[model samples]
Target: MNTATTLPRGPGRNGAPRRGAAWLMLAGALLLSACTTPLDPRKDASLQQAAYTTDRPVVRPTRSVSSFSDSLMCMDHMLRAAQVPTTLITSKQVIDYSSRVPVAAKDMIITSLSQMSRLSNAFRYVDYEVDIVRQDTVQNLTTILLNNNLMQLQRPALYVSGAIAFVDQNVVTNRFDAGTSASRLDTGYSRNRSATVIGLEMHLGDFRTRTLIPGLDSANEVVIGSGSQGLDVAGRIGSYGVNFNVGRDYALGAGGAMRTLIDLATIELVGKWARVPYWQCLTLEQTHPDFQRQMRDWFDESGGVGQATLVQNSLIAQGYLQAGTDLLALDSPALRTALTQFQIDSLLVPTGVLDFSTYERAMRHFVTLAPDGSLQRVGWGPSGPTGSMAENKGDSTPVRTSGLVLTSTTPPPRRIDMQIENALPPGMEPTFEVGEQVFVSATVSRTSHMYCYFADPSGNVMRLTPNQVTPHSLVAANQALRLPDWLVPNPAFIMDASRPGTERVACFAAETDVLPRLPAPLQGAGLVNIPGYRTIEDIDKAFQQGVGTSGYVKSEVYWKTQPKKAQPAAAAPAAPQPAKR
Candidate 1:
């Protein structure tokens, strides 16, 4: 009877054993959930990650003004003293190696020399091209032969020749890797360094004597640094992982390198030939004692106010003046007004007088000459924020006037026309009829990158400069470029009978190509209409309505078109020939 009663009691509700089993099941479910969820114990902890980095450095050649300024000044003085007409004939091949340079580089050297000649009156230069010279020669010869008159050609006393040589070498290499075993991140860093040594040589030869000018052979070397960088990153957490790498290299084009080399070479050669007194301006204590004394006296007397005119000119040269304003007049109401405005803009004390503080502030806007004679521009240091003249107003440094007035004379030396010719049928007056081909010949007064376009009678504008034919925008000085190489009004486009009127062929010239900024809707049925221009005159008016300081020249030609001719009456039945009777 006792054993039967014990068995029945096993089925009792809310027993201790049943409650313990339910609690055990709940605990097991919680353990399983914890095991399946992602866990990060370092979620809010600051831990280092793996990193990899690489760098390539490109070093550019720098100009040594002190080393060459003396020679340049000497040459300038000598050329002025001699008063001889000179012609500089630079070798087309400036580099001795086989590297190719841009044609613009050669032209740039010539342009630089020509500009120097104009500014210093060092020598009378012949700025004409070979063709122009030949044409002039022919005309002179004809006049001389027909009139029995004598003509003379100015010859050069010395012919300058220069060549550049270069050597590139890797100088240094570095690599680094760092990481902790407990972290899932790692990083690596690497750097490669290289140097380029450029050698410049120049010699002066006498064409008449067929000998080298004594003391005119010169050579110099410039060193430039170049390199590259790379970065690598890799990490993993259990099955999850990520890897990434990137790299870049640095280098300069042959054209740019050659340009820098040529400029330095020309400057040095000119200096040597002229025998510029290298110590005249540099050895201020020796040659200009009295001048230095006067500068000191002036600084004390006027506190930099005496040189207001110089400061104003410097401001104008630096483009601080608003458009169409006259140069500031010294000691006048106009000058005071301008100075006050400039001070306000530059965050100065707003004093209208050209005090020492004002002079010092203005000088910071320009290039300065270093003690070693190198030209240094503000904010161009290797390890500092570079500043530009455009940022002069934002500079907050207090003006320092210690030696400002003494350097008034040494104010940093700072330093487009276009023509369009219409090619029409012989004896035509730049006018073309329907179905007749219209060709345009364009030339610029200076070397520039240009953009050419045409607005047709249908009010559609088409790009002509960067077209399929001549795909480059570099237009050399005085060089002729023909538009639409093969006669316009052909298959792609023809004179529209319904919209017969004047079509304009316009060309814009600038030191650099600015075609990308041209208004859009570049290609459509009525682009001119979108601009609200109905006629060529309206387009021209709109085109001229831009800031005049853009350094761009616009020239256009107008051509008219009429209805196509009727098939010519079928030759009028062979004119009945009267048959060559």
Candidate 2:
């Protein structure tokens, strides 16, 4: 473990405060300093896989203007990174649910429509021009928008909501827990399900006024049943249901409760609203109070999340936005004013009003939300696409690309290797005599040596050896470090042991136990250097010298550079050109 100093003690018997303090500390240290054996993850196999914890704040906030952009950006990012459901509004993906399935499918369609409308103008997309007929057993759905007027807006969105209810209990389908699997634990009373959004859709822009929405936003949720109607129930096609044990065989499934199903469907609708805001949807009318605010947030403020104050400060810094009482006040002239304000470069803040320069600037910063849903602010400048503010400009510090190639293909209990390019704290010692091991543990994630010496919050700097607190110029308080609890039993915590003399490099992983303390596995010298092989020395060298990249240059440019000059070298520069001089 890293060496630590004990502070002087309080006076005791002979009024020798320092001596008493040292002795007391010595006793305490002696009692706790013994080397412990490593822990193991195998101790508990169930504690695997990461789950979303409640520590993070929830939802898109309407109070803050930038909150809109932040939510959009995060959603955009998550969509690109994962298989997000219902990514964006389109026709094929969001058809009327009732038309696609049985009459029971209306709830999902209506719910999705309502949610889309709240999030955009398509609040009633599903309800638009929909004709449900008990006689035909089919619903006719038509496009709600008139000649794509809404698609032309700066920010546009669509919402759809659907529902269903079966009064006379009948057989629907063998609904499983997830609807994809089967189990003997089936509901024996009435097997029915009213799934809605199994169909629901949207197009860009407005679709109100006209019979665009087939139904209404206030739609009912479709319910599916768990239990079956007993007594050898038979339909026109086949026989179903149990002959006996009605009550004992069927418990009230979550889907079985009509009230519960409706409430759940409502929650799904509301949850969509809580995630994607309407302003970005561009569905509301011109008179809506949020029209301007919505546009500003989506285009002016940097789209980011979990960092609201940061966004507010950014808008204020540009003098485009400010908080006034409860309402956000925007400087209508910000777009115009900022055009000349930056001889440098920045995204064009979308001032509600557009001018020649405003449009010019906007085009420069037209960050199209890519189909994948990830976004990058491109300066549609004369030179064309440039790097996004989020682009890695290749700082002097080393940046390794690794980890979280997470996928359904790989089940839980996965292990990943993480290496921090820079982990040292500031005021790192110039020289030190190594006589012991430097312990590495999950706690390293919290330890900040740089904070101890320097007065900044940029995390660690000039750190030497992680773990173990020391009697240095600075220290941290409230070091309530949290690590994935399951890994605690593993060597996730450590107290290093050092030889008489040698430097130790410690790498830490979350929720992992220590390696078996086998004698130095290699028989040769303590340090063996490999040339091509990447080792600790190599990593440290790479980190120090900034390897992996020669710094950022376009890959295509370098690709052609390797080829010989295509234009034939000017015929030896025409030796006869001397006459012109």
Candidate 3:
């Protein structure tokens, strides 16, 4: 065992103990002072990875989207179907009282409209008063300088105005608490949740008349809920105590809710104004009451001709009717037969009539169906082909006129017909053997410029007309023109069935020459293959862009080919032995 001995309280010789204490105090003071200035890593610590560093990589940015993003795209197609004209529009900064919401309402509206007009620009936004103060300053400068060319503002046709009408906080609240206590320990847990309501309103106004359009307003709201929970336990014995606590919090973002509300309102306003079937984008089926109302509204707006066109287009896409059939010809036997067949297939009464019910059924599917059923919003333009519009000049053929003069009041009817040159039974789609020679016959409703293309089985489209042999693209009304015209001697233009699949012949007729405006492949000389036109849908889209929906009429005919059946070699004459026998 060791015994402890105590030292005297008095100082040692020369006050050595006190001096030692003083040295310690001085050293501590120096250390404390050193902390005021950061120590250089080179002097104090090795330069390794920082203690606060993490292994996570930086996150890449992606496009921001809300729940209604796809709905906005679907709305774009609706506007295209209606052929809504592009109009200039602008919006004032949306008013908001909730500071938690994003302050980019104007930008959100512009973005939504842009997405809705991707196929056809239905709205062109003009930044006129984005910054009122800057706008005023520029206006003053322009006025004072007396420079007429200093600024030019495009007058907008419409203005969109809106506000975050209300943000009701803590509209609903709930809490739950539970706990168990033991002899010397206690534990408890608590959960609480609260909901808030956000409302937004938007209105469309006629900028020219300085008046808000009646019935073109939207008011929508969203509910955001937040919840959090916590748990804790404590134990104490004598003078000691122990405690633990954990919490969880979850809530919908107010900013995202506000954006969603804005998007919904934009869809409502534009859809109502354009008179389209907007409910389709909202995931509502055609049987829904809202959809029926909207559909009826559209039906009333689009008259008989428009309804017929819609049905015809749908039928063409479904392969029930030939492409490029006259949209206005309701009494045609071919159209009636197609309608009857479509009705039978759809399990409806085969009336062969374009009644309201038939049109409604057709129109509903038209928005959702594409040729391959993979419709997407894509940008298309003329793929450059080497040639000039002048090259489309027709050859010196005797002109035939019906002594009919076209006037503004009597616009030429857009109609075209296509058929195999010598199809059996005269009106049916024909089939040919592989390597069989084929010719296409075309006719127009009036004296018009025509361009024709043949899409082979391999999806390669070749321009069959306006070739060097038969340079005449202009055809007299009601005159049948055969490809590789029999009139031309030693015609180089030839179309021999090559593959064992279906091929299509498409012809377009327009009162004014639209050949130059078409894709480059369609405007080339000789039998050149049209690139990128892989399907009849692709071909139709190209013509729709070049000649527009109303500027020209188109017709299509299909023919199928198969491998020629090998004729069994005539049985060899029975051996001479058989004759001898």
**TM-scores for candidates 1 onward, in order:** 0.36, 0.17, 0.45
Better of 1 and 3 by lDDT: 3
Q: Residues 1-581, candidate 3: write the lDDT tens digits.
A: 99999876666565887799899999999999999978677754443555445455554332445657657877866775565766789998898877657668888899899888654456878865645454687557755554567566779999999998988999999999999999789999999999999899999999999899999999998899999999999998988988989998998887767767777888899989888989778652332223445556656666776667556756665555554556547888999987876665443577888876566555554222122332211111022111221112342322222222211124335577665544254344688889888876676655678877788788887777777766777776545567655435577677778899998888877766787887886677758776767766686787799879888788988888989989889877865655554
Instruction: Report model 1's TM-score to 2 decimal places.
Output: 0.36
lDDT of 3 at 201: 91
Model 2 worst lDDT run, 10 consecutive residues? 552-561
Q: Residue 293 of model 2: what lDDT?
A: 44
How much lDDT does candidate 2 score?
Answer: 0.29
Candidate 3: lDDT of 25? 100
- lDDT tens string, model 2, 1-581? 89999866545534687678899999888767653545577775555533234445664222212112223322332322222222232221222223323323344334333332321222223223333433232222122233444322212244343333223333344543312212323332333333222212222322242233332233433333344333222223234433233322333332223333333333334334444332332211221333344434444443222122232223233333332312223343543343323211222333343333232222322333333343323322222223332233332332221121111122123121121111234344312222221322111221122110000111211222222332231112111122111114453233222222223233322221211221222111222232232233333333334322321111000000122225655555545646655
Best by TM-score: 3
Task: Report the error of model 1 at residue 434, Å.
Answer: 60
Candidate whose lDDT is highest: 3
Enumerate clash totals for all models, in the order shown.
31, 76, 1
Q: Pairs clashing in candidate 3?
A: 324-554
